[model samples]
Target: MIRALNLEDLGSWLLKANGMTSDIAEVAARREPVRRFCVRPGYRARLMAAGQPVLLWVSGDRRRVTPGIWAAGELTGPALVADGKLRVPLELRWLDDDRRVHRDTVRSDGRLADLEVLRQPQAANPSFVTAEQMAALRAYLPDGCGWTPALSPRG
Candidate 1:
């Protein structure tokens, strides 16, 4: 099992990433959980379930920081809190070698409505990812990698 990490801690990391301050970044959170998203250097944000290499954009716009906003596209994995800093559950996505006993299990939690699999060998991600999954993805972030509290600008 992996040690569960919180978005608050993540924000601290992101502050170091962008050369920002944790206290100020926490202020950027605006009393909400932080969020990190994977995006390409060009700014295209999305990650397929198969673990294909893609650009990642770690973001969080606490009121005390730049942009003071947060946004992104498909977030593949790593610990990203969705509702009020609650842990979102996530299961693995693997291709069946045809030697398995049962189909892949589905993840369901109260904070998130549901993240059902649209494809077998691949997964069609629906909503935001869980905090645990995001932490594991730090390896793929850009040079300024770290945590960033997310604040939605609009729908």
Candidate 2:
């Protein structure tokens, strides 16, 4: 399993550090360069698309981060997700693109629903990764309207 380098919170949802660590593992597992970048006030993907060190706005239950907010450091949490639903609490570690290390834990509310894996495209054309990598990337997702697994590069 992936280990935590660090973690943060926006509301109550705590994005897993090991998740990102697993990302690093995937990079190593793939044995190639991983295009890594922190988000601005948006999702990491958009931040990279627009520019580096962009502002990121995360929405969680525990941490209610106002829009256009900025922070710099690691964050961690013990959020509980019932049946692994996204409706659980989150604690977003407030940090910037300069920092690369962070972590969080996803706890289910003892509801063992079958874990669903999905896939999509990065842009609109064609390209995808596995549900594993997709889930890993989803953990870093910022708050937005079009931000869904259907809108991302999936396997």
Tens-digit lDDT track for model 2 on 23-122?
A: 4333333544322222112232221121111122222232422222222111121112344431212222343432322212211311212211111101
| Candidate RMSDs in order | 19.4, 17.7
lDDT of 1 at 148: 39
Question: What would the per-residue lDDT of candidate 1 be over residues 35-73, giving only the tens digit for each residue?
Answer: 342222211111222221222111234243332112212
Where does candidate 2 have its weakest 10-residue lDDT segment?
Answer: 4-13
lDDT of 2 at 29: 35
Off by over 4 Å in 1: 1-121, 125-128, 145-153
Deviation from native of the Cα of residue 82 in model 1, angstroms: 28
**Total clashing pairs for each candidate:** 19, 43
Candidate 1, residue 13: how far the Cα is off, in Å: 20
Compute each candidate's TM-score over C-alphas: 0.20, 0.17
